[model samples]
Target: MNTAPPHQQAALLRRYQHRIHRVPRNLVVQPTGFCNLDCTYCYLPDRDDKTPMPTAVAEAVARSASELVGGHHRKPLGLIWHAGEPLALGRRRFTELLQPFEELRRKGLLEHAVQTNATLIDDEWCDLLTEYGFRVGVSIDGPKDLTLRRTDRRGRPAFDRIMRGVERLQHRGVPFSLIAVVSRENITHPDRLLDFLAALRPVSIGLNIEESEGVNTERHPPTREQAIEFWLKVLAWSRRQPGGTAPVRELERLGRYLRMSRTQRADRAHLSRVDPLPTIARNGDVFLLSPELAGITAPTYNDFRAGNVLEQPISAILREAHRLSYVGEFLTGLEECESTCEFFDYCRGSQAGNRYFEHQTFAVAETDYCRVTEQAPVLALADTVRKERTT
Candidate 1:
């Protein structure tokens, strides 16, 4: 646990002032609310709805992008198509959805990516992916035994299907990345996970600790010991790589944070002004800070919607985002995190969705999500590097 001493904690809190610098650097658009697989741990509430984003809603999103992505942004906005298996929308319908953003892409205002189960990747899908120059991300949990939880509607394992899709991408020569969920079943087998990832050969890898969020109330969050051991194995594996560990997202983040000077670490500008990371639903409703919160219905929080783009530009919603009840409550949580957590400089705060799902409110700090994802990894990596320097 990164619990700062009292004097330093007070100074840190004074610096950040508990303000969320809301910036729209990325847009996560749900092309549809249907997934082909019934992964046991999926948090999406409407995975079976099969409702694709209306073309008009997509057009509305694009129209609003100018306001969100224009002006002083030095890089193109990241437009990620995710949630409920984006590929389930089908190629033609998916193409139609992408059409609205053609101008944005051409104008260099946006870059495209897709987070998919990879069970739908065929030559045609690969063609579409290549045509758009997408940064493809496959959601695979490792070999068959580890992925038994990821299944189709009839309860058939999707491991083989997912691999076939991966094979298709490799055969088509498309570069890609992988995002794997780390849970109880797989947390103790870091070597197995790393070996599988090495064989698959994604350009990069991101490990998302299994979370208790939205509809997935039953979660087996890894123990602190399990998480630390897992990350240490990953860090060691990464160290042995001749090139570097940059491919492992978690280790890379740890390295960068550890390398920062104390002054740089203390600089709260980047930490406090985290990208709001708006996730737009098929209906044009926007969920800020956390994409996982999209499409969830919590009557107490107005379904966690900042606003619907169909009604107004996302910029307008963002401009008034601080006034939204949940957003305000979340800011209060940040104050708590800054005042207490020694890892606040590195983590900023837990995701809004995690806070809400775990505690049922945004005005709280810390959760199993942060412990396994943030604290454990940081401690593991930092201890490993320090030991290495001394040795």
Candidate 2:
């Protein structure tokens, strides 16, 4: 479908030739979709089933994962335990699911992490997480009022539970991070949000702009100008905080740019690591791009089984990802981007789901995400750095 001229295609091929054989370092595993709290803006829609992966299935996935990474010169795999709440599988099953990966770690094959809503965390959970050195990322918006919509099917506010979970993690001295979903209701009070998170003092912070494809489609998505304004305010607040390691998302982009320019590390870009950043669901289905695409059924199938790890090799899975027309477009965009934009070295381009939702194709130009992620923040950071140097 992409009909670029021969010369342009040749140049693009040369630029990306260095990246042809790169293997992924991170893999997201969904134990189940059995989350306790039901956030309004959740991208995963079918969270009611609450089915846990059988121990055998989890073992097979771990074995396949080990084989995949082992074939790639034993590159360390960062296994990210993600879900409707990975903790919903409970501690015992959770431990069981992670055992094979722990064995791989013992063999020096992989690393493990768990991303949770923190509503189910306890001292025991904290102890297990700390014992395994599992990096935990808590999902919280801002404050009780802002997170009022984060409730259960019974319409009970989960703020108290989540806070209790955070307290346990803090008390146990477990290293963890925070992930906040920014929406129209919360974007106006950026300073308040930052201040609230600052009190918790997370290792890092990730702020995601609300997308319209999931549970919150009825809610108004924030405009690009509004999101930019919110991020700018947050950046100003972050600069004033002393001894804080909480890397704001937008500021991290600037930091990533600086690091890439100085170090020339090809892996510094966000989503450019490699193909098939594996996202394995509870039923053994492996999603290629991201976990957000879990519930989206293509025109043919009714369920979210993109492919199964038990039946296919990881290399074949990655090949399928490469064959996608949108994947090619996304790669083309990245290859050409650096010529016109200095920040191209840092951007991994927009997430595939974002492109799919906004433009109906993963490979298309990221006009929406670019408005806030690329265009506004990079230019502002460049200007500020230039002004400071000149001054």
Candidate 2 C-alpha error for residue 389, in Å? 8.2
Per-residue accuracy of model 1 over 1-391 as CA lDDT, tens digit each: 1145667545444432336554567889987889999999999998989878999999998988877766765688889999899998889899999998998898888899999999999999999999887999999998899999899999999999999999999999998999899899998887788779767878889988898887888766778888988888988777777763338887777667667744466664455476778789998898888988888888877888888999998878776676566776787788798898998878878688889888888888887888889999888878887998999
Candidate 1: TM-score? Answer: 0.92
* Residue 211 error, candidate 2, Å: 1.8
lDDT of 1: 0.83
TM-score of each: 0.92, 0.86
Q: Return the TM-score for candidate 2, rounded to 2 decimals.
A: 0.86
Candidate 2, residues 1-391: lDDT per residue as tens digits? 2246778656555543344334667778888877777777777776886888887767877777777676566557888888788888889998898787777877667878888888888888888887777888898888998888789779898888889999988888888889888888898988888788868878888877777664445777788788667766776787888875577866876776676678777555433544457788777777766577776766432233446877775556665454444446556665555556554555655455666666555545555666666666666566556767999
- Best model per TM-score: 1
Task: Give me the runs in candidate 2 sitting further than 4 Å from their true place.
Answer: 1-21, 71-75, 262-275, 300-306, 332-343, 383-391
